[model samples]
Target chain A: MAKVLLKGNEAVVRAAIEAGCKYFFGYPITPQNEIPEYFSKELPKIGGAFVQGESEVASINMLYGAAAAGARAMTSSSSPGIALMQEGIGYISKAELPAVIVNMMRGGPGLGGIQPSQSDYHMCVKGGANGDYHNIVLAPGNVQELVDMVQEAFDIADQYGMLVIVLADGLIGQMMEPVELRKPKARPIEPKTWALTGPNGGKPHRIYNLKLQAPDLEQDNIDLFKKYEVIEKNETRYEDYMMDDAEFAFASYGTASRVVRTAVDKLRAEGYKIGLIRPQTLWPFPYEAFKRPNIKKYLDVELSMGQMIDDVAIACGDKNMIEFFGHTGGVLITVDEVCDFAKKIMGGAK
Target chain B: MSRIDRIFCAGFGGQGVMSMGQLLAYAAMLEELEVTWCPSYGPEMRGGEANCSVTISDERIGSPLINNDATVGVFMNGAAYNKFKNKVQPGGKIFMNSDLIEDSNPRTDVTYYKIPVNSIATRLGKIQLANMVMLGALNDQAHLVNQDMLLEAFKKVFGAAKEKYIPINKEALAEGAKAAAEMFK
Candidate 1:
């Protein structure tokens, strides 16, 4: 396959088209505006639909409507916009709707600066609307993964009957890279037996998260928890680099993970045996990978900040082996800082 | 495997610094080496300075960050030179656009090559392609990558519709290369 130069935003839209997705609803936001712009031009060419909704809230609701109608639908927004759509996302999760949402996160607590940031780590994994629900979040580091994960996101959303998120950041969204567009596979146009496709033959099918009856609502929550358990058991993914002979490891995800990978390589070349543990799936968190007896003996934790360290501590048993370093509000932690931390840990200087 | 060569290119936003780094990385990939090209942008990309990093190696690259001692530094503007001059490795080469950079000051330990990239681009009838000219010069001086590989990278980037620009770009590349070779001699 020949490579084509594409920005990260454009790559996601192209991947959506290749994943058999026919509907996209989104509003413009910094660092991710290119996504909606690309979809506006390309979706119509393929007989697909792209709508710039009135707001992120309306956009996510449109996704909900399309997914309920058994169409492959998606929406994208940045940190602030995503926060606005949280209520709608809660509805989609409660209703078990199959849809993909993209969060090209920018730095934020409120109206934060427009720079790439992993500040949304907690929001994406732990803050999906309101109740007891989890959205399968896929974090992509580069444009290639951005393209590949979009397709994978759709499949995961449909198969699990839940909302899926492709998490990226301003850096990944604005960057350009060479990508080969994959040929889309033909999928079944018919909705699943459980989907609310208007009473296929006999009884009318209704889809909604609101079950006023206590017994029915309890059963629904139980069923959703069970599905999450299965996902936890089966779907965690992580990449390990140079860990076999290392005495310490740095853990990071998304764009920060890529930076950690470079730092690890440089440290290795300088004769420091440092390793990197990068999680591709943020929710299930790949706890088992770090829990391995060998890795436990050699692992320390690192994050954009103290956010993901909680997961690391949980995974590594809170043994004080985990160390945290970060600069908040979109400030990038340099490779030198990470190397110094690894050196101190290895040299027993701390 | 030996360490991957990581290069950082920095300049104003419209200088095509990102494109230049990407072309080099892509060319290395065509040579069957592993490569990664990551551009820095955001609010920092609008009218502010922009930069990118390219890592090319015999094995898979773990990350794409360029540390203080990077293998190569290409500065297309005075601001880039001022910001990154101290970061180049002792023996590493610093490529600067002589047309825009009036001051040739750099660390005494590192070798600096000043190429008139903007002037060459003006001569070529397209001033925006100055970045390409600088890339051509760097490719010749470093020989870290092959000319054919660079051309293949350009083909991948520009595609067929813009095929006509190939000859002009190649000419620009060749002119820059020849000028750099002469300066070193």
Candidate 2:
């Protein structure tokens, strides 16, 4: 198929359809309303289901219901909306159901502005609401990556029987770009042994996390962590740019990482030994990318006030070696600011 | 050698500034170049001053926001003109709406052209064609994408509008292109 021009929100819908997402449940929110809008108009045409829930609370629970029934279901929202869905996300995590959730983050500690932001880093990667489980979060830098991540999120969700999140910003949701539409590929079918289908002859199929005993719940936590360990070993993804024998590096992801790319290129042209480590998978966090032998310092750039810096500090294993440059409440950090910081950091004056 | 061209378009709401920039972006997509189009999104965007930034490149676009490095600035009113005149880079170009702007404190650092877009569209008997008129002038000036590709993009975007207005839009485009060519002469 020919490449088509698509805004990030529109691409999410198309990619979800390509990934065989049969049910969508979401509410209207800035920067991501197009997801539900497209699904409402297109899902029915494909004999799928689309429901605009009364609120984000209702929407995420709908995703939980559909996923428990062995259907590929998804939902999307912005920052504040995602906050309302957190408890449901915790439920989905505990239920061990396969689901895809898209969070096109906007500014927020409360009801913030409708612009791009990466402020939900801790909420998305660490825990949103009383969670002992981590959502496999993929941060995509551009529209093409957003498309790829949306499709991949479904497969990963099913693979681990977990929730996967495509953590993009409002900028990626609103910006328009050209993307080659991926051909639909069939997902490997897994038998729905635990699904709530019609019962077999006197067979018990239980799918619940309601262990009354403390030791039993603790064992559940330990088993979940063991699965997470396997994911951490096999699923961590990152991009290394110009890191060979570099003295300094910037660790960033999503939209900020795109700016870091240009800054690294321009600074390298001026003979500055700077590189970038972009972590595409935020939950796995890609600590291996920060283990360069010649690295002397690390600059962290983001759309929030150093939320991702904690991860970078841990990845670098020296909190003092990492410096942060960021703006909060939807103000974007420019490439010039990143490059200037790169110069200052590599000069050993920080 | 391939390069990125950043274009900024500003006008009052309903003047099709976003549509104009998107049309060019779609044309660039048809040309198989890397492109990004971002419009101002805020409470003020509803029937207020509006602007969009478009970047077409051979390499992946780094950022979609327009800083002070626009290669082309298209202003359709005095407010847009006053706001963005100083933002274009040195040796860049400004295509202004002469019908709505009387005087501009011209800068010698960049090329400037005053195209009578509204007048051309009025003469073409459809005021909405003003954006198409300006786009035609931009084509003459920047040569960013082929004229035919733009027309094809227009057909795709203005698909419903074309059933009744394609002929006049075509004429408006040619007339704007002709006027722009005459300016260079």
Candidate with the greatest TM-score versus the true structure: 2
- Summed backbone clashes in each candidate are 1, 0
Question: lDDT tens string, model 1, A113-167?
Answer: 7888887888888875788889998888788888988987888888788799898
DockQ of each: 0.49, 0.74
Worst window of 10 by summed lDDT in candidate 2 chain B: B160-169
Model 2, docking class: medium
TM-score of each: 0.91, 0.96
**Tens digit of lDDT per residue, candidate 1, span B105-178?**
55788788889999999999999879888999998888769987788888887788888888899998998898
lDDT of 2 at A75: 96
Model 1, TM vs. native: 0.91
TM-score of chain A of 1: 0.93
Candidate 2 Cα misplacement greater than 4 A, ranges: A183-189, A200-204, A348-350, B44-46, B160-164
The models' CA-based lDDT, in order, is: 0.81, 0.88
Residue A148 miss distance in model 2 (angstroms): 0.8
Q: Give fnat (model 2).
A: 0.60
